[model samples]
Target: MLDRPTFTISNVRSGDVVSYPLVLFDGQLHGASAATSVTVSRIGADHPRLRAHTYTAPSQAWPVALDTGVFKALAFLVPGENVIEFRAGAEPVAAIHRLVVHYLNAPWDYCVRAVYVVPADDPVGGFQAPPHERCDIDSAVHRLALAMRLLQSALAELMHRHGLGRYTFCLEEPAQARACPSEGGYEEVLVAYGVPVHVHRFKHSRAALQALSGDELYGRVGQALSGAPDRESRIDVALMSFTRKDAHTGMLYGHTALGGGRLALFGSGSMFSWPENLEQVPRRFTDRTAVDGRRFLDDSAGRGEYWALASTSMGAVLHELGHCLSLPHPHNGGGIMARGFDYLYRLFGVAEPQPGAEMQAPDEPRLDRSAATRLRFHSYLIRAGSEPHPATLYPPHPPPAPDGAVSVPVPSPSPTPTPPRPRLYVATNGLPARARAHHEAHSAPRRPSITWQSEGVVRVSAPNGLGHIGYYLNGDVAAHEEFFQASAPVHLLDIPWREVCRQCGNPPAGAKIRISCVDHAGQIEEAFERQVGDRP
Candidate 1:
């Protein structure tokens, strides 16, 4: 019997622009007594063999030999789309694999302008400086300086993570006394009703923003920064530090007018302030310490109220900026664009829960495959000469699914088709009593359930033959299992909970576990389970 030849490619992905010294290894030369031949060909109108390499075993044993090869230069790839194929040996017995390469043009430069806003009556008093910089006189100046410093540092961190190292932002000198004008008669009605008001606050509304032209908003950013219109590509963000709450909660946080020349309004109160009590912060936000032990400029030891506040602010800005860049909040629980701020705080390692806290640790933040693909698509659009509108870059969110439903599967046409739904279960001894109580209280029939045990283990059983099974924890692919036989038994997979958690960044209160399975004929099904319990 002839063994099948196998090989592996290293350090390059499909469509990636590769550099020199391509590493290829783990070649098994099958059914060869002597040296085996391999040819590299560029597939096109005229298929040309780029080069030939030989595989020889250190000491030949029997029917197979192991070897490695390297390609020094990839001069064969042309400007646009190119296909590279590797064939081992000749004719029908040869093992062949192909890779497609898209040699891309230079990436586009996306720019963002961060404008700091202060109250008109007290232009400098909204921000607070460091202890050493604090002065009894000119407190406003100190406040403005502190606010500017915090925002700058936060923006820097934000850019490094989401910008893919290509986006840049400029911090303009603080925009002072630039209050949004209120409607003449509306202010009188609010005053008659005894509604509290702040004179320097901008009216955070779409209609209010639409009433002013781009030039009027640009003017508020100060004369030195008024040239942004000349740089039509820039995303203008006004960071307002306000003491009074807006009538609407959404307005208090901030608002963006994507149609209004890529402009966004962000309130510092929600973004920069941390709750006085550590317990008040979500468990996920304060569960993990920073991996690098890096602290912010204002944070001395790197894990406390100051660090939490700074890190949270950075995450909030990143989230709002993501919207500014035309990206929407993802359905998954990971990444800056997700529903909660806890993941962001955990991603930066700025906070962790005090010992013996009841709350589950925050799920760590990650740029999953979907988010990366969306970003890449946006980049491609920018590179293809599409006018960049930082606000409307991505498509809007699809309508929500039925309550408690994760996802619905597309219809299938196969006879003897596999079930369209898959079931998942978890057994963990590490779940806290309170968490268990919460889970049991909210448990529903047919819904995914968590069971208590002495050890943590996840068991996945499929009635239909399992062709491919993938395990995802907290939105990242953790592990996968495959069955190649055409007629395999009902597949049962048992995975250690510790192993799954380890692959998912060790979220303390357990991680969100998602399992996707494909049947023998390629019918796909998915199930989601949130593993809530004490850390094992």
Candidate 2:
């Protein structure tokens, strides 16, 4: 019916060379109400697993309705050029437009592996999900893989927006990649090549998994993957089950976020709500589905429902992945690591689906300057002796990249295997251009049971530009406090007895105060732990 370019792709332009495999096609269908669909087709690239175009939306076979005129879809690219076509109202098509994107798994060979951890006794290879959010193991694999791609694009965009270029985590290839239970590797609809999701069957039973705490499972999972073929090269992104131990409380197990030395492995609960396919992805973000508290893990905690659940569950994984890359929680900002990852939808669509769920004057999730600076030096995204890719060079403008971060290499059209590289981001022996060290000593301190200056204020400060400070109580995964003084490294605070108590309930007796500092060089330092207050 229509002959003009009725489709407009936003996030990217045609002929742009991208480094990552997964790309979110953010754009809108101009004018009127009619059937619309986006199809991915290859131009010159030939991948063993990748076929022509496997992902399509709002199709007769499986309808994934788009958002009004504004819509977004995920496209996994082959080595060379990729052509994504948009069509509406079928044949000769109502309105059509096509865009091309590129990917070369370049200088950075270190990739994030999407791993599915299954207990030996589980039948369907399924975790807990409310009836409204049920998907089989095969489906779960597709969902997780899709989620990783979305995250990859989100990160690339985050870094790019901040003028650091589009750098993101890579995925394992056909060699080390493992397919889920269903087909060997159909990927989503099982027709094209999709990033491999490694499946690891744990020897323990579901009950055993449930019995372990988050930390315990983190260690167990890390140990399991420690014996991997090339353990030091890949950062494991693992998925496991979490079940409620007490019928009265909603506490469950199997949530781990520990990453160091090629080991950033974990995800759980809200995964049930994770979109199972590209079509369902956007909808999943705004998914207003109520999580049946008794059956599924409520990751939203009350901020929102399925939409919030998806954000935290998926975003949390990315956050932990950051930790794996040596990224620490920043001092004061809602960036991904600082718990403001709810804007993943913002990367694609213009609005939120659920009523009252819309984000306004948003506290968006991002990779703040400090995070960008740190990741810039990370070995995972850059090579020590590599030069920058001509096509994707950073724009020499304001908000420049961290020093020594301008030149980075893009993968060749066909990815090649590089020598094994260590996961550590900071150099061990001799120091680099910039040197940083952390020191903490309480002034006029009391005995072992004393912390705090009788005044309620924890002091913190940072170097010229370093910016991630964390406060913890006793020994817990969640940081009870974070002081983000990017310039001055000192900010007073109420000792754990009062301030932290407001956040983490009554900590244990003689609860100790711990602080962590991560500079812009990916260096991590755990400050001294000072005990605060009485044994209440």
Candidate 3:
């Protein structure tokens, strides 16, 4: 019998940090006469979870062929250490190769000092339950703990996608509220339908809580904790929880500084409504299992109203923390940073029939490639002991040419304005009717339609000096190709459609495709097209 094809992992080894979204696995399937299949799976505790299943044609299976076989896996690694296994065939045709992925710098660590703010009259500050009777602060502490856990999980997933590991969040002992004078006295509001003002004061009042800007609060906390000898061991994150909204903006969530040391504030009222029965709060909040070293709170339980509340509250907390980590809101679409539960559903890849459930949480939130890249860059700076600056991370767009620098056009001396260099066009197949209609409706006349196949192959013929070719989906660069010398025809056949769809907001069927080319002189040319395909 002919020898079974031999498969090996060529590009990555046991410990390697691959880029986010796309991880290329280069290997040869020897002695294969026809197309063969390969499987890439993430090693899990119970079983191997399939990540990608792609086939290679005969012409591309051998190393001697013009196009060597390479499998691209879309990785969404969790933070810390993640293991992925590769195999060739449905039944172990090749020895499994294991890869360890890390999402953060190995020695990076930070501690979060949680401060629970309560009314001055309250005897004991911070989170404390009564000896026998239920306490009012039970729900606040429960939600805060749950939110922190979710935030850690989301950050881990973001780091994992980029292949860094060992990022941790240590929750320190809760700090007591600092006594501050009440602002403007209390304004009585009606409670329980219509009640006497005197009685309403006992139940609820619109008394403003003393407010301090995030910067001011951070300084105060830093001074209060200055006595600790291990101050330099880890970065400080002051997680201040309050009973009322910020007096200045009425905003309940905000943070100051990102990386190094920072302060994140949360208003309990903004997180969740108080439960009528304090017993409703999950006992797991205080469970030993909830606090796992640098990792805290567990999302193991799949049921209960408190879980849903915790999940929703956690979303808010995670969103604010994202800011502290230098992540911006992708306001254009749904994600943790976007508005509403739509982002949560999309993150977990679930549809909620009953949107009112108090215990719904995303399985794991995901970061787009751009956001992931930004976070990785900031994390690197933090590990290197530098404060992150927006200008340093993302340079400002070039300013328009100054008026003095603009040269007046001397009417081209040639009577015939040098025949406009023949309009360059990128050749591709025609778009489907639906895609064509969508393009015609949304695109401008300057953008031309180019045809492309489902395999992500695009043909281009350009003048000499072509330095690079870029393929974009919905404005985001999806693939890049570099050329040493200009050639008659060039093809970009490695655009990972799965990742492209993801970056393009995972359109239902039709998506906008654009091709941009930059010549050696830096002159840029582009063509736009649309395609309809099954969801990636």
Candidate 4:
């Protein structure tokens, strides 16, 4: 209100609580021109709690990218309290003020570990570095650390956008001999300024890695990164950079997969363009420079290859992580489980260098509603104290009227590992769309314990307290997916035809959709396959 270049932080106000270490702050300035420079620096900050830990380092401020008056600033905050200052224009220019955002590290135990998988044959830790950068372990560590931080912030933002608070998976801090600062016996961490990455040299050489198939690749990562698989505590992101370019032919073998349980592998081909430091984050997003076609996977959207690699590498890892968490619902709807992660930069920056027709100004990537339910109730993501007690039993959900929900009576929640499996019932009312559940007699024998339900019109309910509804259609590909939360208003998770078509796009002329509903306790009973098009 007072100066020519009015600097204001819109996303987060002064004294608001924030969780992630590296945060993007978006704001506006009316008076300043497009080229006006906006620099951000911290005046003074302090971390009262966990003060003794050596990793609780100070925060750093970075320059803001101001485009046509609207600007985006990046800042790093310590655990307890962080004060960030933003100044618009040059030294003597108008509107330079300081703002503060409280930093409260989320209280979570299960952590996401950032690990760089080094091939035994290579000793120097050679990896493709950003242009004119070093290809060493230190550089790999910085690149991986930045990617992990971006992933952390992106999840937090997406969950918040879904009306759920800033809930996200925890990232492991530096190794510490001392116990966590939590009051109870739980995981307590402080996300400081720097990215802490672990370099694990695989006993197997590059030849072994190249020879391994997808399953073999996942198995290797599990054996190396995930120790004592039973009730594992940490989820590891195993990143590798194994690329070779020669005269005749080139080979880039990225043994990437969404390994079950605790590990996910990622290839860092575009990491050279990734920000090693906090300041370069803005510049990295808008980098339109083309990438070596033979060396890396071309993930660049309408923007340049550098940015596409950043978005794809990071988002692709997250997608795999989602599968690792047992949320492998079919890639339907424009969600993280789908291909929505290409515009990951939109979550942080207010603008991109060159925008395509589909690329909007402020649209960001996110997890769909069904995926949200899965993440919220996932065994790993559940907070230490917030876990459901086996002894406690919830009441039975009211069954649907004579139309959709059929005669099968629902059961109450139980503590047993394998409780009574839920049954599938369909409504053939044909009000909206008709998907009739075949009577056991007419139901064709497909596979053992498999039946075909006329999809697009049906009532499939998972009465179990915690449930997930999945559809694997067109052979291996997934069509529509759904999940029910433990705190859902009604346990009868209805799958209407109208909603099904909306959630799952049009299937081919002839495709079989295998629908499965599994309870959290590993009980699977309510399931069948649906045949689309004229019955063959």
Q: What's every prediction's RMSD, in angstroms?
A: 21.8, 10.7, 21.5, 12.0
Counted clashes in each candidate structure:
9, 20, 15, 2
The true-versus-predicted C-alpha distance at residue 446 of model 1, in Å, is 50
Q: List the residue pairs that clash in candidate 1.
A: 124-140, 125-140, 127-143, 284-361, 284-362, 286-351, 286-352, 286-353, 429-453
Question: Once model 4 is optimally superposed onto the true structure by TM-score, how far is the C-alpha of residue 509 displaced, in angstroms?
Answer: 10
Candidate 4 clash figure, as a count: 2
What lDDT score belongs to each candidate, Candidate 1 first?
0.37, 0.56, 0.36, 0.55
What TM-score, to 2 decimals, does candidate 1 have?
A: 0.31
lDDT of residue 261 for candidate 2 = 57
lDDT of 1 by residue, 1-536 (tens): 56655444442334433111111211333443333444555565242322211111111111122232322112134334556665665555566666765432222223344444443344232533233323221232223233333333333233324423211233321121122333221111011001111123333433343344445544443332334332434455554443232334322222222213355544343332332221222332443433221212222123445445445554555555555544444444565566343334443232234444413645444444334323322211121111122122221322323432222122221212333333111111112222422332124332222232346676655443444555566655555554432344445666676665665556656557665555432234455455746454
Candidate 4 residue lDDT tens string, 305-373: 776667766777788888766655445457677777777766666566566653653335778766664
**lDDT by residue for model 3 over 1-536, one digit each (tens)?**
34555555543455543212123344555544343444555555342322221111111111122134443332335433457665554343353456775432212223443434444344332332222323344444444443443344445444444443312243432221112222422212111101011100111121323344655545544454444323433233333333333445544432232222344444343333222222222222211222121112122233233334344444555565555544445525445554332233222212232355523644334554444434432321121111132123212222222421111111111111222121121110022222322332223432222334566644443342344555566654554455532333233224455554554556666666566554322234565455648432
Model 2 / residue 32 / CA error / Å: 5.2
Evaluate model 3: give its lDDT.
Answer: 0.36
Model 4 residue 276 lDDT score: 72
lDDT of 3 at 346: 29
Sorted on lDDT, best first, the list reads 2, 4, 1, 3
Stretch of 10 with least lDDT, candidate 2: 439-448
- Give the number of the best model, judged by lDDT: 2
Q: How well does each candidate superpose onto the true structure, as a TM-score? A: 0.31, 0.64, 0.33, 0.68
